[model samples]
Target chain A: MTAPALKLKSTALNSIHRKLGGRMVEFGGWDMPVQYPAGTVEEHVRTRTHAGLFDVSHMGEIDVRGLDAVAFVNGLVSNDASKLVDGQAQYSALTTPEGTVIDDLLVYRFAEDHLLLVVNAGTTDKDWDWISSHRENEDIELRNVSADYCQIAFQGPDALGILQKLTRLPLSEIKYYHFREGEVDGVPAIVSRTGYTGEDGFEVYASPDKAERLWNKSLDAGNFGADDGVLACGLAARNTLRLEAGMCLYGHEIDETTTLLEANLGWITKLNKGYFIGRDRLLKQKEEGIGRKLLGFEVTDRGIARDGQDVLIDGQRVGQVTSGSPAPFLKKNIGMAYVPVEFANEGRAIEIDVRGRRVGAQIVPLPFYKRPKQ
Target chain B: MANVPENLHYSKDHEWVRVEGDTAVIGITDHAQDQLGDVVYVELPRAGDEFVANESFGSVESVKAVSEIFTPVSGKVAEANDSLTDEPEKVNKDPYGDGWMIKIKMSSSGEVDSLLTAAEYEDFTKAENE
Candidate 1:
């Protein structure tokens, strides 16, 4: 069949990916690699065991500037932005007026007067419009900077030590979820100590013009003298790693119809921070306790229970699985879904409909496989 | 892709069948494994299960997606690869040899000729790419 006529949005590293023999797939309108020839399992294991490089430039980046940027951004997000010090980052959420989530994002405080918002790719346009339209202060400037920048993530236990070897920036000085602008290999970059994989990693942002070169540099360093140096990961490994880390996927766990509290991301919400979008509804939900809570599960049978599969208890559908797969590291099928708060505890028995058969499953604590401390 | 031996017959759905006596050893082609990402699980039919030609017998789960395994010819499943439960990645490593999914007692040996040759399979995949 002829390739679809739909134009795929290419990132700065598209040509580089093609050069690397990446199997390309269209994801959320962007032509991104789903895996390299070494494949998704190898990439997933590499990220956990050593280091893996990923081109996440398709994710939307926004810049909030001007005098009241902090206050303006804080008022629009669910997290306590006032607590984010300069050069630090915080996971936060943008909510609808009804307390449903607009998107989960990471807010990096560049300075007291400037902030950077990294949002999910599929929800970037909506997030940008929501934040810009709700800006009460005219001093704040919200610009969609996604096109102007590229994000390359090097995630694994050795990520920091490897990065420190190339940068003058003090690696230990930067705490988790923090950003520091510095020169690595004499190249300008913004190094953030954060990652989706359950390992210590850094996300570096650089100019699109220099992104390809920098990506090559990182990949070269990652694979230095090894049989398979830095492995290029695709969306498949990325999803598994993030899900293993117990992080929520935007449209799956949290979306336009689910509040942060119900999504079990209330830890990021600051109830006492006064007003923010959906604050009233979130506060009410908190007081009443979430009706249905997102819980993690592992299949005890052979079948993999995928998204939209019914989660049953005693032959009745009690909840529905949101996301699931066979975890490469754990060698077991695991997933997350919304279940009644009473049945959300670890070790609770649940049945997943695998085709026409109800397979045995157990509610388990997330991070099915955590990286061993180095 | 790895070599496609001339003795093997291929199906358009990317499965390869090798006839040894009255039984045929069935496995996916190297090109199929290349496209499926990494094999994590292989769900094979029981030994006694019977399937019609072109019908799905089981599924192969990769890290990326789960694809059904189509029978190239109607037959009774003589044996399934139970070892795949713990080592599905073997299919990704050497799909033609140790990665074989099942052994079937062929209902009719004549059905084997209808399948594609190695050259035909290569051309088929190339045309698919086009």
Candidate 2:
């Protein structure tokens, strides 16, 4: 492939990746691993059944501190920020005045007056500039801590067990969508109960200096198991796992042109709360149902449906797929698409046009596969 | 690493065509599985299916990308690998051994000679590396 227009940035583990025979691809301006020597399927299966390690250092981290941090952040995003307790995290969308999504991010209340926002890698610069330009007072200090931090994800049933071995902090105490700052391997780290995969996993945020050490330590513990406890996964398996977990990617599932209601993220919108940038538009959407909505589908036929493939209902095109792949956990082709509201219901039968032929599909509730209970 | 037997004729697309009497047993090469990642689903061509040279005969789905498995030579498919229905990952685990896709009756044996030699395929990939 020709060199990308933008420089493909690498994580701390880039050298480690090259040594492991990873097929690197340019993804969102990041020169990330697409697959390893074991291949995408095995890495995916390992993540679902055992544990998989991922270097998410490319994602951006922003810290907001000051007495007015809560109020300052509350006016900026769609979610109710005041309701988040210390150590709690919530998914929120930053939007334009017209209610178009700027980016979807995770907001963690680290202290009574401080918050940490994790933004997407590709849009980090934009998000940072947007937030910076809008800051009017010293009451809120916005710091782009992206460069200083590196993240390692241990996802699957055995993730917690492996993580507990390294941290003196009680791993079980951290609830889902929450995080706690503690020391691991003598390095200050933030352990979060958040994972894209729908499994009991933890995302560890440590300094770049300590990233490789933490990763090797996690691998050395022999967590995934007869061969190795953990396999280093790539962006390929990460995308599949998140899609299987019914998580929405920022660009594909929701963008500046789409609203939360249309993106099926209405649960994060609160009308009774203090005002935010897109509150009025979201309230309007609540009063009137969205015109088109995102829905999940399972391909019953042979072909694997892909992004931009047309979704047909009764021989007429109804929508288009945003993200589609062969679901490893389900062992079938599954994806998410944006369709007319009338056809967005779960269990509705539909057809997807693969190449030229129509393939039988069913509009299933998202997260086509959930990890079997531990 | 997967097994790549020396006796089989291989194509650059990572397919091995093992000549057996009047039929040729075709399967993906070990390199193909290494490239494909995890094998979640496979779309096999039906028996008696006619394939044109270099045209897609089937498709294999991994966690990330879907790749079309192309025919190395023009021929009629006699039978598909029945074992793939339940053990699709066999391609990844042992491409040359049990992951064979079909048995094809060759339309032209001349086409087989044009396919890549094992050494040539390896060199082709090595040259393509970043």
DockQ of the candidate models in sequence = 0.63, 0.45
Model 2 lDDT per residue over A249-328, tens place: 98898898889888878788776887888888888887887889998999987678888899999889988999998877
Per-residue lDDT for B1-130 in model 2, tens only? 3455667777777788888877778888877777677676777889999998888988887767778888888889999987887788888777777877888898888888887776777676666553
Give the Å error, residue B98, model 1. Answer: 2.2
Residue A64 in candidate 2 has what lDDT? 97
- Return the lDDT, model 2, position A126: 93
How large is the interface RMSD of each prediction? 1.8, 2.5
Which parts of model 2 have CA positions greater than 4 angstroms off?
A: A1-6, A38-42, A45-50, A222-224, A369-374, B1-10, B18-25
Which candidate has the highest TM-score of all?
1
Q: Where is the poorest 10-residue window by lDDT in model 1 chain B?
A: B58-67
Question: Candidate 2's error at A12, in angstroms?
Answer: 1.3
